[model samples]
Target chain A: MPRYKITFAYDGTKFAGFQIQPHQRTIEQTLKTVVNRMAKDPDPAIPVIGSGRTDAGVHALNQVAHFDFPFDIPERSMVRALNSQLPLDIVVKKAEIVPKTFHARYNAHKKRYRYRVKQGEFVDPFRRNYTAHYKYPVDIAKMQQAAQDLVGTHDFTSFVASGSQAKSNVRTIYEAKVYHDEALDEIVFEFVGNGFLYNQVRIMVALLLEIGNGQRPLNDVKRVIAAKDRQQARMTAPASGLYLVDVSYDE
Target chain B: MPRYKITFAYDGTKFAGFQIQPHQRTIEQTLKTVVNRMAKDPDPAIPVIGSGRTDAGVHALNQVAHFDFPFDIPERSMVRALNSQLPLDIVVKKAEIVPKTFHARYNAHKKRYRYRVKQGEFVDPFRRNYTAHYKYPVDIAKMQQAAQDLVGTHDFTSFVASGSQAKSNVRTIYEAKVYHDEALDEIVFEFVGNGFLYNQVRIMVALLLEIGNGQRPLNDVKRVIAAKDRQQARMTAPASGLYLVDVSYDE
Candidate 1:
């Protein structure tokens, strides 16, 4: 058997989630179904493992995944075969043969995520599914200043939602930045970290927005992180505006 | 009865078209449903007349429509009421009280349309519904040069599709331009005209693309228009990439 690594993107508006459920459509299950059909062997189906699970309505720009095929095929042919069978909402950008020891999830060193917030009172129908709408006025300068406290290693227990099953609550954040996209009238938040707890990114975005709205003090992010309690950060932004931007592995 | 003029936008991916149909979901029917539901009137339901009909999968950024209401309501309140009940894919951007004599369709003096073509070999899942994919190489300069021939008043019998109901094919084009969007990797074609026959903009776009691909001579547009034959223009671009950008009226 040969192991393959694939970089793919999907519009998650129509999917249940990344993990498989009995009667629901999911990213992992869809990929496995396509791969098994191509292999023509179902006794022990090929498994599709993603770097992480994304909630429903969360999109992906570059998601990494791995699967082991029963036989060797040219990477180009494999990509073409998978894409041809896959639905229009999903696309495989690149495929390559990798060492058998490589793991899609465990070998990943860094991940980047983006959260988009539309700054306006009215929701644009064209962007309703792609951005979270905020009606209040936001202070961009204050949001940028507060995002600085999110850098460096810290115990992010306050940001993790209740359903996260991670064993450790501590994570290192290499970068955290918030900026405005003038052309799109959107506020984009970017984060690069070792990993993120479930709902961590969305929760952080909610807290940042509150701070920018002047409802919370400018230094509230520091207090919230120090508290290490989920109750301290109350709101979680909508999942539709989140994107799993990129995942990196130590090659 | 007071007439209300409204400007709105819709994501047409889920719509059958802009007209009322017996069983299909349409933009006009959807808008009328919401308006009638708000009006609480049964006999002679409010008629929502749009500036023009948009084909299935064709989007609109600022579509104009008008309807007569038995009772009067503030313009701002009308906008809010319509948007609150309308689905997320459609949004009412503006509303105004107009005279009873004002008509939505016949009173329009100018219209602007845009066609978006993606320059790539692969389909981006995020952009699949918004842009038409062109895999072959294209010459932007040649497309721009050919578009100049379309900027004058002319009989567009060559560009009119078979289903058109217009009495005459003569239409005045105020502007025709082709430009590239570097960030999105799209070649956008814009046309401003007094009026267009059925499938006129799409047919022109297809011919311009063929010219850009070097399949047709540079002077083909002039010859095609002079021939006054539908057979001269063979292609109509996909409706998914076409947009009713704006409609103007001489108030």
Candidate 2:
């Protein structure tokens, strides 16, 4: 058996998520189907493990994943082969032979995610489907300050969705920042963490949005973290604005 | 009746096109529905004539349109009211009172359109739905020169679609230029023209793409235009990458 590392991107609008579902379209299923066809196996029961699970309508710029195949395929040829079978909205950017021990999910050191929100009276027709549109005037300065409070290791239980089944709620967030891209008329929230609880990024964004809109004070972010109750946080932001930017692992 | 001009932007992914269709979702239909509701008339036959009819999956940043309303509505309030009823993908940016004779489609003096194509092995997930993905390396210099030949007034019959029913294809092109946006890994094609025939932009893009990929000679653009035959042009580019950038009327 040979293991291969693959980097890919997807629109995520038509996909349920990266995880495989029984009958729904997913990134994992799409990848597996394409890879199997390329490997000359009609129904290869290959399991693909992604770096992380993105919610519905969440996109990925550089998502990393790995799968094991029974036969050897040239790395360069694999990229072309997989892409030919994949839909236009999804593309395999790179494929490389990796050490058998490399695990896409377990070996990841850090993951970065970005959430985009348009704060204006008019939304760009081209970007409307991919970005969250909010007409309420947001205070970017307030949001930036609130984002700073969310950095560092802490129990993110309050930010996790109520139905999340993660065993531990504690995670170390290396960085959290919010800024406005004037050219794009979008507010971006970026986070890099060792691991994130389910819906953690979306909830944090929701909290910052509340502060940005003056619905809550900037200091409310710290109180929300300390409270450790899901009820204490603001509503979860829509999934359309969220993106899995990149995943990294130690060599 | 008081006539009002409205400037709007929309993500055209979900729209059939900018025109009203029978039992089909369209940007024009949606806007007319909102206007009819606000007019306090049951099934009011309000018509929203756009500056141009963008194809399905094409976006608009500064699209102009006008409709006659029997009641007076403040400019700012009209924007807010229409936005409240419209989907998140469509937004009314500006609204102003215009002369009773104002016409959205007929009074336009010039229009500008932009076509975007991604030129890298890796596609941006955030932009995949909005940009055309072209993995082949493009010869930028040749494409730019080819675009230059397309500038100026001439019969654009070659660039028109086969089923186009326009009486005249002679339109003046003020400017036609192609440039690469390195930061975004995109090649942008901009054209300022008095008017465009059906699928003219897409056809021009396809010809440029053929030149970029070395399938057609750089000088072939002039020959295609001279031929004035729709079959002389290359395939029509996808509509997802096209955008209606602006519309101008003589003062």
Candidate 3:
């Protein structure tokens, strides 16, 4: 058997989510179906392990996954074959042979996420599916200054949604930043961290947006993290604006 | 009755073009349905006259149209009401009361169109609906030079599709230009002209793409226009990448 590491991207607009569900269209199930057909083994379906699961309507630029094949094939050929069979919404960008011990989920050391919010009174018809729309005015400078507090290790219980079953809430954020894209008239929020709690990025975005809109003080992030209460951050940005930009692992 | 001119935009991905059809959903039909409902008249449905009809899968940035209302309403109110009632894919941007003699189709003096082509070996899933995918290598300079020949009055019979009902094939192109958008990795072609016959822009784009790919010489545009035969230029670009950018009228 040969194990392969693959990098892929998906639109996520039409997918239920990245995880498998009964009678639901998901990225994992779609990949499994194609890989199983290629493996020519229905007895034990091929399994694809992703670095992490993205919520519904969340896009990915370079999602990493690992799967084992019953037979060996050229890496380039594998990429072409999978892309040809998969739907247009999903594209396998790269495939490479990897050691059997390598795991997509366990070996991942860092991940980066991006959230895009369009600033305008009316939703742009073309970008409705890709960007979250913000009607109120916002100060990008205030959001940028507030995001610095998200760095370093912190207990993220204040940001995690209630459905999460994680044993611990401590996480290290390597970098967090905010910038305004003038060309598209959009505010972009990026977070790079060792790990993130469920809905952590979205919650932070919501709080930052509030602060930028003057509903909260510029230093609200510090107070919210210290409180460690989910009620401190009530809003979570819409999933349509979120993207799993990249994932990292040691060679 | 108050006649008004409205500027709107739409994501044409799900529309069956700008013209009304018997059973298919179209931009014109959708607008009529909403406006008629607002007008509270079913016996005589309100009519919408667009500047021109766009082919299926073609987008528009500022498509202009005119309609008459049974009663008077403020311009701002009309815009807000139509936007609220129309689907998320269509948005009314501006509305203004115009003279009763104004015609959206005949009042236009100049029109601008844009065609976007993504340059890559593999199709980008995110841009599949918004851009045409071109796999072969292209030279922007060659395309730019070839496009210059199109910036003048000429008989465009070779570029017009077979179904055109225009009395003459003569049209004047005020400007034709091509530029590479590095950030998006797309080659954008723009045309400003007094009028274009059916499928003229698409056909010209196909010929320019061929010239850029080294299949045709830089002077192919001149030769093709001189031929005055439809078979001289056979290829027409896909509609997904075309956009009716703007329409101009004399005050």
Candidate 4:
């Protein structure tokens, strides 16, 4: 048996989520099914783990995952083999043999997310799946101010979706910023954090955009974090705008 | 009645072609259906004409067309109205009223075509619909040389498809070049010509790719053109890689 680490990208518009659910398509289940098909003697219970789960319609630019299969395959050949069998929307960007010690989810140290918003009079249809359409004008300074107020270690209970039940709500956001690309008329919000609760990033993005739109005050982010109530941050941005960009290890 | 000139873009993956055909969906038919529904007194026989027809699966970034409608509508509003009704794959980029004498097909002086090829070990799934995968090493210099040889005024009977019934095959290619975008790992072939015969751009691109692949000699383009035989240039590139980029007028 050998463990293989795979880095991949998926459009995510059509997927249910990254985790397997009954009668639904997911990245984890898809990988297990594919790897089993490639095996000489298929194993239905092969284990495949991802760094974390992404909600439905949330994209992944470079998601990290690992699977253990009972075969000896070269790295380069594995990339070509898996890609040839996978669908067009989900692609394995790279594959390599990793030490057995590496666990995709348990060993992860940090994750980075990118949220994209198109702020223009007309939305390019080509970008509809990848970016959230925010037709209203935005003030970048206000967004940056809200982002600054949210950075640092804090109990992000209000930012998390209501159903999430982690042991602790404390998380450290190493960096957070909003940038506007004039050429594309897009606003990109990137956040690097040790970990995120379910739907935390989208909620934060929605609130920041509201502040930018003058619908909410810039200090609302700080108040929400201190309040520790999910109902305080009501807006949850669409999954289409969020992307899990990278996963990092302590090494 | 008013004549309007419209510039549009389309993904083209689902469209049969730009022209209406029996038992098939097309850009023209889609546009007519949309405009007819928009009209106060619906005219089912509205006239819609494109600058030129694009083959099935061929995309467009700046395709020009004109239509005559029974009602009057402002250009900006028309753009928004048509877009709201049209499918995501087919988008009307701009719309404005034109003189009755302005004909999209007849008044066009030049048309530009762009073909993209992905040459690498693995094709990025994200680019599958937009590019043709060649999966081989290409000689950029060789492709450039062939592009230069194919440029200028010539009897391009060899490049046209066999079923074309044009009176003359002579056309001038104002510019032809092959460029490599290192970041995208793609080769782009751009051709600016007065006009092209049926399937001329695809055929030219096919032969140019063959030359780049070292399967054909640099002088083969000239020999095939002088021979004035479609059989001399057999390969017709797939429609997925082709794009109608621009249309120009003498006015």
lDDT of each: 0.92, 0.87, 0.93, 0.88
List, residue by residue over A1-251, the lDDT tens digit for candidate 2.
78999988888888999899999999998988877766676453678889888887898888999999878889988888888778877878888899989999999989999999986566555565578878798888889888888899999989998778889999999998889876676899999999889899999988888899999987998999999999999598888898888999988
TM for candidate 3 is: 0.96
Best by DockQ: 1
For A139-227, candidate 3 gives per-residue lDDT tens digits of 99999999999999999999999999899999999999999877667899999999899999999999999999999998899999999
Model 4: residues with Cα > 4 Å off, grouped in runs: A162-167, A181-185, B41-43, B162-168, B182-185
Chain A TM-score for candidate 4 is 0.96
Model 3 residue A17 distance off true place after TM-score fit, in angstroms? 1.0
True contacts kept of each: 0.69, 0.46, 0.59, 0.31
Model with the higher lDDT, candidate 2 or 4? 4
**Candidate 3 lDDT by residue in tens digits, B18-88:** 99999998999999998899899667678999999998999999999999998799999999999888998
User: What local lDDT does model 4 show for residue B161?
Assistant: 85
Q: Which predicted model would earn the best lDDT?
A: 3
Total backbone clashes of model 4? 0
Q: Give the TM-score of candidate 1.
A: 0.96
Write the residue-wise lDDT of candidate 1 on A65-111 in tens digits. 99999889999998899999999788898899999889999999999
Worst window of 10 by summed lDDT in candidate 3 chain B:
B119-128
Q: Give the TM-score of candidate 2.
A: 0.92
Which candidate model has the greater lDDT, 1 or 4?
1
- Model 2 chain A is weakest, by summed lDDT over 10 consecutive residues, at A120-129
Colliding pairs, model 4? none
